[model samples]
Every structure is written in structure tokens, then in C-alpha cells.
Target: MLARLSTDNRTAFMSGVRDYSPMLMAILSWGLVTGIAMSKSVLTVPQALGMSVLVYAGSSQLAVLPLMAAKLPIWTVLLTASMINVRFAIFSAGLAPHFSYLPFRRRLLLGYFNGDVVYLLFQKKAFATGYVPGKEAYFWGMALSAWAAWQVSSIAGILLASVFPDDWGLALAGTLALVPLIVSAVVGRSVLAAVSVAGLVALVAIDLPYRLALPLAVLAAIGAGSVVDVIADRADLRRIRTARPAAGTADPTGRTGRTGRADLGKES
Candidate 1:
């Protein structure tokens, strides 16, 4: 399938694969943990497999599993899942400018493949370059690699859940695997603020019913980040204004009034 792509696109695609390779272990660990959890839950093996294949969202699946096990109403489960996945809306918005020019079906497929790690990596690597050729190919490379790793590990976990002892602490391993990724993404003050706020909010609301804390943390983080961004923008605007010469007060030859008058006196 990749052979159909132009040489530049193929190169970009492979570069994406290489860049995303480092995260595959983390993805595998999380997928395995999620699959094991689903298997051990009230869901039957078929249901667990189905979810792993179809939903393809470990976080949303994990968030909604308990509700499902408790026989919650369908609407409640759907609502909780939607709220938990609300960040995807933001991710989609970030991605739209890059991929919106594609055919509708292609765009829909791309959305299905989008994930937290993929979005982050794409933003860091390709977003600044804007909507250029080979960007989509690069995205597909990372997306396909991640999807494959997840599905393979998840399926293995479902099949081998009984073989792996609970004492192995795989869940902790999975969580630890994500720490590096999170730390790497905290590159600026806004991201730092968002992360800190989200962590605090999640802890504070941990005991909320129906896993409400997750959505609360997400929203709080976005708000905090946005506030920080607005402040930074305003500060930048003020600095720019302060640096500019007052209108009609200075000569157009890059000279201030005092400097221009001094030059005039010297010329005289």
C-alpha cells in the first residue's frame, strides 16, 4: 500500500514510523493493561475483543467499563464516555487545518486513527509546517504503527489474562511508561500550567461518582492553559506596543525626535 505514495511521502512516512517507534513500548503496555482489565471485568471475552477492535480508545473503554459492569443506563454510559473523550474534540480541531482538505471519507478515517500520542507527536513534528504534502502520509505511518501495536498487545492480553498474575504490577508499569511522554510534552508554561492544574483537579475530585473526575480534570486543564495563553498573548501585545514609536511622533527614517533634532543641528 505504501508503494502508491510518492517518494517524498514514503520518506516522510518512514520518518514518522521511526519517530513514533520509541513510544510503541508504552502503547503496548497500556493496551495490554486495558485488555486485561476488560477481560477481568463483567464483559465476556467476545465483548472485550470487540471493544478492543472497534472502540480503539483505551481511556474511554477503561472509563466506561465500570459503568457497564454496574448495569448503568445506556445513556449514562454514553454520556460518561463522551465527556471523557471530549478532549478529542480539541484534538480534532487542531488536526482539522492540516487534514480538512482531504476527501470526507479519508478525513473520517484519519480521525479514527488519531490518538493522544499521535496528535502530540504530529503537532511537534509536522504542525508548524502546515498543510504540506507528505504530512498525511507521515500521520498514517505513526497511526498505523500505534494501531497495530495496540491491537496486537491488547489481543494478547485478552487471551493471556489468566496467565499473567495480578502481582506482576503491569498496571503500574503501564502508568510509568507514560510518564516520560508526559514529561516531554511539558515544554512551555502553558502546558506546565495545564498539567499541574489537571493533576490537582484529578486528585481533588478522585472520589467523585461515576468517574466524573476525569472529565473535570480535562476541562480544568484546558481552562487553565487557555487562561495562561491569553495572558501571554496580551503581554506580548503590550511589549510590541511599547516598542513601537508613537504615531506621527517620529521621522520615517528610523530616527527618534531627539536624534533627528540633534542631526539637524549638526547639519546646520
Candidate 2:
């Protein structure tokens, strides 16, 4: 399938794959833990496998499983899952600018394949370079690889849940593996603020019923990040405003220093 792509696109695609390779272990462990949890829950083997295939959201699945097991109303389960997955809305918004030119069905498929690591890597690598060509291919490279790894590990865990003992600490290993990824993503003050707020909120609300803490943390993080972004933007605007007149004064050409000869001619 990749053979049909242009050389540049194929290169971009492979770049994405190589960048994402480091996170494969983390993704696999998390998926395996999720699968084991689902298998041991109220869900039958078929139901577990179906959720792993269709939902493809480990966090939401883990959060909603207890509610489902408790025979909660369908709406409650749906609502809880929706809340936990609300961050995907933010992810989609971030991704829209890059993929907006694609067909609606294609965009929808891309959105479906989007995940935390893929979005993070895409933003760091592709998005940072602006909307250049071959970004779609790059995204697909990471997304497809992540999807395949997740499904395989999850299926394996479900089929062999009984073989793996609970004391193996696979869950802790998965969580630990993500720590570095999280730390690496904290590139700015806004992100740091968001992560701090999210962690604090999650810890505070850990005892909340129905795993409400997860959504609460996500919301808190978004709010914190938005506020920080606004502040930073305003600061930048102020700096620009303050510098504009000085720059104009220094140039005396009203061209914002583009013509370096203005000041030289004036001094002469």
C-alpha cells in the first residue's frame, strides 16, 4: 500500500513510523493491561474483544467497565465514557487544521485512528513544521502502527489473561512507561500548568464515584492550559505593541526597520 505514495510521502511515512517505534512498548503494555482488565470484568470474551476492536480507547474502557459491571443504566455508561474521552475533541480540533482539506470520510477515519501518542508525535514533528506536504502520510504511518500494536497486545491479553498472574505488575509497568512520554511533552509553561493542574485534580478526586476524577482532571487541565495560553498571547501582544514604536523610531522609515539605511542616512 505504501508503494503507491510519492517518494517524499513514503519518506515522511517511514519517519513517522521510526519516531513512533520508541513508544510501542508503552502502548503494548497499556493495551495488554486493558485487555486483561476487560477479560476479568463482567464482559464476556467476545464482548471484551469487541470493545478492544471497536472502542480502541483503553482509558474509557477501563473507566466504564465498572459501571457496566454494576448494571448501571446505558446512559450512565455512555456518559461516563464520553466524559473520559472528551480530550479527543481537543485532539480533533488540533488536528483539523492539518487535515481539513481531506474528504469528510477521510477526516473521520483519521479522527478515529487518532490517539494520544500519535497526536503528540504528529504535533511535535509534523505540526511544528507547519502544513507541509506528506503530513497525512506521516500521520497514517504512526496511527496504523499504533492501532496494530494495540490490537495485537490487547487480543493476546484477553485470550491469555489467566496465564498472566496479577502480581506481575504489568499495570505499574505500563503506567511507568508513560511517565517519560508525559514528561517529554511538557514543552511549555502552558503545558506544565495543565499537567500540574490535572494531576492535582485527579489526586483530589480519586475517590469520586464512577471514575469521575478522570474527566475532572481532563477538564481542569484544559482550563488551566487555556488560561495560560491567553496570558502568554496577551503578553506577546503587549511586547509587540511596545516594540513597534521603538522599532519605528529607530528606523525613522515607518517600515519597522526593514530599511537599515534610514537610521544611517538620518545620522549622516
> Could you tally the backbone clashes for each prediction?
0, 0
TM-score: model 1 vs. ground truth: 0.89
Overall lDDT per candidate, in order of appearance: 0.89, 0.89
RMSD of candidate 2 to the truth, in angstroms, is 4.2
* Backbone clash tally (model 1): 0
Please give the lDDT score for candidate 1. Answer: 0.89
lDDT of candidate 2 at residue 1, scale 0 to 100: 86
- Per-residue CA lDDT of model 1 for 32-114, tens digit only, reads 98988899999999999999989999888988888898998999888877877888888998898887778999988998999
| Model 2 C-alpha lDDT versus the unseen true structure | 0.89
After the best TM-score superposition of candidate 2, give how far the Cα of residue 185 lies from its true spot, in angstroms.
Answer: 1.1
List where candidate 1 sits over 4 angstroms from the true fold. Answer: 126-130, 247-268
- Judge candidate 1 at residue 198 and give its lDDT: 97
* True-structure RMSD, every candidate: 3.4, 4.2
